[model samples]
Target chain A: MSEMLAHLSLGFGVALTLKNVALCFVGCLVGTLIGVLPGVGPVATIAMLLPITFGLDPVGALIMLAGIYYGAQYGGSTTAILVNIPGEATAVVTTLDGHQMAKQGRAGVALGTAAIGSFVAGCAATLIIAALGAPLTRLALLFGPAEYFSLMVMGLCFAVVLARGSILKAFCMIMLGLLLSTVGTDLETGQERMTFGFPPLSDGIDFAVLAMGVFGFAEVLRNLENPEARDVVKSKIGRLLPDWNDLKQSAAPCLRGTLIGGTLGILPGNGAVLGPFASYTLEKKIAKDPSRFGKGAIEGVAGPESANNAGAQTAFIPLLTLGIPPNAVMALMVGAMTIHGIIPGPQVMTKNPDLFWGMIASMWIGNLMLLIINLPLVGVWVKLLQVPYRLMFPAILIFCSIGIYSVNNQPVDVAFTALFGLFGYLLIKLGFEPAPMLLGFVLGKLMEEKLRQALIISRGSFMTFIERPISAGLLLVAVAILVIALLPSMSKKRDEVFTE
Target chain B: MSLNKIEAAQGWRVRSTQDLAAGLFMIALAGLALFLSRDLSTGTLRQIGPGMLPKAFAVICAGLGALLAFNSLRYNGEKLSGWSWRGVIFVLGAAVVFGLTIRGFEIGPLKVPQLGMLVSGPLVVIISGLAATDVKIKELLIFAAAMTIGCALLFKYALGLPIPLAPWLLGI
Candidate 1:
């Protein structure tokens, strides 16, 4: 405990620096602006801003990016409450009761509860990281090739379960992603497997290019498809503070959300996306009148909001400790760290304690900053929502084209992104979720490497995975999840959960 | 008579065209991948080579695709939505044009000179702007101009990127 304090104090010393604080503030501000805009998400925003961070020190860049992540979460709720549009997938559940509250002239209370709940969750999750981060890193260090491979398998299975719509469709998407990831020259042999003799593809597709296309450009296409679907609330702004009754009702849900989110966020493959949905379901089940959930229950807004923010923070744990990214945002972080010649993993805490601890400290400070920015700026955000999709989409297109072109000074990358944008749109049209594909893409190379390594070590025996206790346990869990998903009764329940 | 007529309906037996198309697409992609990677050596498990994983992924994708295609026949799903040709063509066209113009293109004996960041930036913005249903000519032109300048200043001057600002023909 003393050592932990010492480390935290050191972290504070680094994060409290004027330069770092300014970076964090700027990141949060920009993050909120983009987050408030429907169809613009952190994945694309971070990818666009990646080049800007090339100029900063690793610690400063990461701190700023982390600020943008959580800030976007806070800002997404603002849009959900005011415009009935979710700026990000994590904010989807927020729209249920949040929009209703806006209709009931309780927009101010909904926004306030979200901000306060997020702040509380952020602070709690930050402490959780500070306390458990090192131990988690130690645990990660014990994982071998087989264990790592099994863990990724489990992660992919979880992704399939959590995805909306048919499990088979999601599985197909994951397989496609894995195939895409296999493009480029093989590491073992000097042979190119799927590049089709293309020179640029010899090094593989860029993550930023894929993300910008799928999340940014494809989203623009989706929004443009149905112009009338987006409706901004024009009602008068109400009081911004929650009443004592509101606070009393929200306290327990907020705590429960934070706990649930903090635990799930540690899992790989975008586990954070599951937190808010799960929390909302839990809140509805436990409530005296469940029907009030979609009708603007305070608990609905409070629980999911807290879960979203807490999950955002704790999702960083895997990236920081194990050098493994649980989601697309963390994958981008891995790319950012790589640009600075720093490989994230167990060694980061020991080698660069300041960077690790400083980032954790900045998360808390960033949350405080978000709370300040979100409350007073709610009106400004609401006004920004009035910006029509027509103008908004063009700007997004220009930025995406420019950002992608800037990556390698190659126009081919931009062209590839455009192609992926169309592909993403097609997937969405087909009721296939893109999130699992992203997870598969990010983990593909590592999973392949680990699988090969484990196989080689075991002399071609597939039983190597089962021979190891940790690997065996993880595989069992994955198998169990698949079984449960396939069960007739469970499949019906899953459909209900997703449809709700 | 109503029951017999309802049961005899035989148009679009696959229930969801979207799912059927998605499944067929996946299957085709998997087949292509397998065919392309057939030449690569799939080393044994102890010495797994590049082709091994690709082949494995192709098999899995094919299997999943088949399952999805089968499922589409049994389950009712969402209908395929109308395509926005304007949005698709203009947005994708803008990107392709920017790519070709920024660096220029050459096909056999023909050559197109690079237009640099200034020309390409506005070219992209204006072309993509045409996709919008409520495009205002004056507003769009102004936005295009502003965006080009802003991009030049931010990317080239401020960020120190080496994007060219003008064509060699301009002698800038």
Candidate 2:
């Protein structure tokens, strides 16, 4: 405990520096501004701002990115409440009661509850990350090549099972992503696998280019097809702070939400996406009158919002400790870390202590800043929301063009991003979720390396995975998850859960 | 919906055109990957060469894709939606133009000079903005200008990223 305290205080020392604080503030502000826009989500907001972080120190860059993530989630809830459009899928639950509350002239209360609930949830999850980071890193250090490979397999399986839509399709996306990851020159042999004579393809595909293309440009293309729908609340936002009654109603649900969301987030896959939905269901089931759920129940907004925020924060645990990204957002984080030339894993904690701990400490400050800035700026955000998508999307396009162009100063990247943008649109229309693919892409190289190493160590015996206890355990879990997800009865249950 | 029914009446058992297309696409993708890696050696499991993982992943992907395709025939699934050609053309056209003009590309007789971000930025904004069916030209042009200036100040000046800001003019 004392060692942990010492580590945390050192983290505080690094994070509280004026420069880091300022960067965190700016990141949160920009993240919220972008995320408040109707179609932009946390992923797109982070992808757009990714290039800007290249100029900062590693610790500051990560801190800013973390701020952007949580801030985007907060902003997503705000959009859900006022505009009746969830900024992302996770915010879909928020829109159910949040928009209804706006219709009932309780938008301020709903927004307030979301903000406070998120702040409370964020603080708790930050502590969880800090407390768990060291021990998990210690445990991760014990993993061998076989174990690491199995762990990644488990992570991929978790992603497949947890993913929305057909599990078979999700598995296909993951394989495609792995295949795409193999396109560049081979690491050992220097043999080009699938570059097709393109020079840029030799270096493998750039992460930023792929992300900006799929999430940013493809998103603009998708949104352009849909008709503009801006039902911004025209009435005055009465009060920014929740009254005592609202607070009393929200307190327990918020606590419950944080606990559940934090737990789910620790899993290897993108379990965090399910956090808000699960919390909402729990709140509804246990409510004094379950009928109040869709009718702007304060608990409804409070629980789901808290769960969403907490889940976003705790999702960092796997990334920070084990170098495994549980979801696409964390996959983006891995890309960011790689750009800074810092390989993520236990080594990150030991070698770059300041970057690791500072990020954790900064998360708390980021949450506090969110609470400080958001309550007063609700009206300004609303005013920004009225800015039409016609205007907004063009700016997004120009910005992405510049951002992609800035990376490597290659015009080919811009063209490639355009190609991927179309590809992404096709993927979306084909009922394939791209999140698993992104995860697979990020982990592919590492997985391949580990598989080879393990195979070599065991002298071509595939039983190395089975002989190793940890590897065997992880593979067992992966198999169990895939089996459960494929079960006919269980498929119905999953569909029922997702219908919300 | 009516078109789907007609297709069904035509005695084609294909249920989801979307799935069928995706399956065919994946198979093609897998075939291409395999063809490309055919020259490389897939070394034994011990000291597995570069070709091994690529082949493994591609084969698995092809298998899953085939399953998806076969299942579509067995079960009713989503129908293919028409593509937004207007949005695709203008948006992608804007991006390609940005790429070409920001740093001009030349292929034989086609000679284009570097137009720089100053021109490319607004050009992209204006061009992509036209993707929307209800785009107001005058407002879009103005937004394009303002956005370009904002991006210049933000990317070039504030962030200090060496993005070409009117290279033809400022010679930076």
- DockQ: which candidate is best? 2
lDDT tens string, model 2, A1-500? Answer: 88778888999999999999999999899889999999898889988988888888888899999889878888899999999889877899999998888888888888889999999999899889988999999999999999999999999999988888778788998999899988898888898888888888999989998888889988888888777678888766778788899999999999999998988989998989888999999999999899988998999999989999899999999998999999999999999999888898889999999888898999999999999899999989999999888888888888888888887899989999999999899988888878789899999998988888899899999999999999999999999999988788888888777667
Model 1, chain B only, scores a TM-score of 0.89
Give the per-residue lDDT of model 1 (tens digit) for A223-257.
77877566777776699899999999999999999
lDDT tens per residue, model 1, B129-163: 89989888788888889988887887777767767
Candidate 1 TM-score versus the reference: 0.95
Error of 1 at A96 (Å): 1.7
Candidate 2 per-residue lDDT over residues B5-45, each given as its tens digit: 65556664888888988887788889999998888899998
Q: Interface RMSD (Å) of model 2?
A: 1.0
lDDT of 1: 0.85
